[model samples]
Target: MDEAARRHNEKMKRIKAARDRMMQDKTEEKGLIIVHTGAGKGKSSSGFGMIMRCIAHRMPCAVVQFIKGTWQTGERQLLEEKFADECRFFVSGEGFTWETQDRDRDIAAARHGWELAKAQIRDPAIRFVLLDEINIALRYDYLDIEEVVDVLLTEKPPMTHVCLTGRNAKQELIEAADLVTEMSLIKHPFRDGIKAQQGVEF
Candidate 1:
């Protein structure tokens, strides 16, 4: 074969081998919990990416958005229009902590949202559950840490992937999470007195 053809055949072979390996590791109803945390942005964006990937594979997902209640983003718009039936998105009525400043109200809303969020854990239909901004609620003690941990540990279905995102994740949640990512903020437009843009920060 010519040089280009030889390289193409080699690439095909590698792809086939990788596909076989993935098939070998595939299982029915197994689930994973992913936690994305830190003092940086993009936590919800990362979760949204995973949701999109799951939707691409025809898998169901549920999202509980905390703190980020009012602002609308492109992901929300797309999910609303395109994947309306594939995923569930709930926005908490209580806004950010600094804005609300009502501990009782925040805690109450967190508890109410947890009722819905926990259902996704045991739901075999939902392949992925994204708990957006959960870490922030946990950090602020808006939700009961032990109760949340218990539900996560005991209720998740097999083959399900859970994604949690927010800043300042508790050490206990990190210990329980299968995959944890800490996003560090090197710079942001907020530092330069640029207010949160509609598409970017929302």
Candidate 2:
């Protein structure tokens, strides 16, 4: 082999050895509390990806949408149509907080969504639960953080993974989650006077 190719192979060999050692130490499996937050987009999109993963494995799942209420989303429609028997979907908001401008009404809707989420979390048969946009509800004080954390840590099924997605996730939630991903905004179409398009933004 050429000198350059021999060096490249040696580098890859070391990388593989290190990766194998890391993998060997990760033998335990348990349900995860995943959080997707920050100002960028794709928070909910990532949560939906996890839902698809669970569905592909034939694992029961549930979704509780706390904001974006009744607004048509392609992922919701696809899940409802293709995996109706395995997924329970709920929408409990009346659009954005600015649209409603009613604190009491927003609180009521958040509570309703939380009730549905709790039900899903308690269901042993449900292997995954997606609390879509729930971070925004928590950020607005529509739901009590302590109560939400308490139930998630104590009452959720041992093998049930849960995902909470939205901007401005609370520090408490991030500290409790097993995995956290923050989407940073580098560039967006909206800043360039582009409108949200079907299949891309929705």
Candidate 3:
């Protein structure tokens, strides 16, 4: 072959090798863990997006929500009406953290929710789990970090995905996570004395 032909052949060889590697990587059985944290909005929103994506693919999903039980939104209503059997939604039942200042009680509630989530996490049929506001519960010591991490590491089936949402995720949890997304608050309407909009922030 001529010089130019030789160069072109080398490039083609490199591209083919890269393609093979990519295919192998895609075929590997790997689980995905996503953590959305920081003091900002959209943590739950981002996590919900993953839930929708999984459902679109006909994958079973489980959702365990800590705090904020009363104000129902489009997602809650839609999940209730549409994907009731496919997912599970649990509330802490005491509204916000400050409202339920009892640490022991809060921890107990979290433990109960975690127990339910543990079963879903182990189920190979369930492809995705969205642990909404779970990080905050861990940060506030409401949930046991060791127990959560153990479940994440051991209970997950092949190709299972998990999304955890809340503010101020613990360092250990962040370190253990595969993907960590921090939603930093740049500007919020609440700062301007505006109340949360219905169906948007809810």
Q: Is candidate 2 or candidate 3 better by lDDT?
A: 2
lDDT for every model?
Answer: 0.84, 0.92, 0.81
lDDT of 1 at 84: 84
For lDDT, candidate 1 versus 3, the one ahead is: 1
TM-score of each: 0.83, 0.98, 0.83
Task: For residues 54-147, write the lDDT of model 3, one tens digit per residue.
Answer: 7788888988887766578677778888888766666654566778788887878777777777877897888888888888788888788987
Q: Which of the predicted structures, 2 or 3, would earn the higher TM-score when compared with the native? A: 2
In angstroms, give how far residue 45 of model 3 lies from its true place: 0.8
Point to the candidate with the largest TM-score: 2
lDDT string for model 1 (1-202, tens) is 9999999999999999999999986664447778898888888888998999999999989888887776676787788888889998887746787787788888888877788898877788988999888888888887888888888888787678989899888989989888899999999988899997776776
Indicate the residue-level lDDT of 183 in model 3: 92
What's the CA error at residue 161 for candidate 1, in Å? Answer: 0.6
Index of the highest-lDDT prediction: 2
Writing each residue's lDDT as its tens digit, candidate 2 over 75-125 gives: 889988888997889999989889998999999999999999999999999
Question: RMSD, each candidate, Å?
Answer: 3.7, 0.8, 5.1
**In candidate 2, which residue ranges exceed 4 Å CA deviation?**
none
Q: Residue 130's C-alpha lDDT in candidate 3?
A: 87
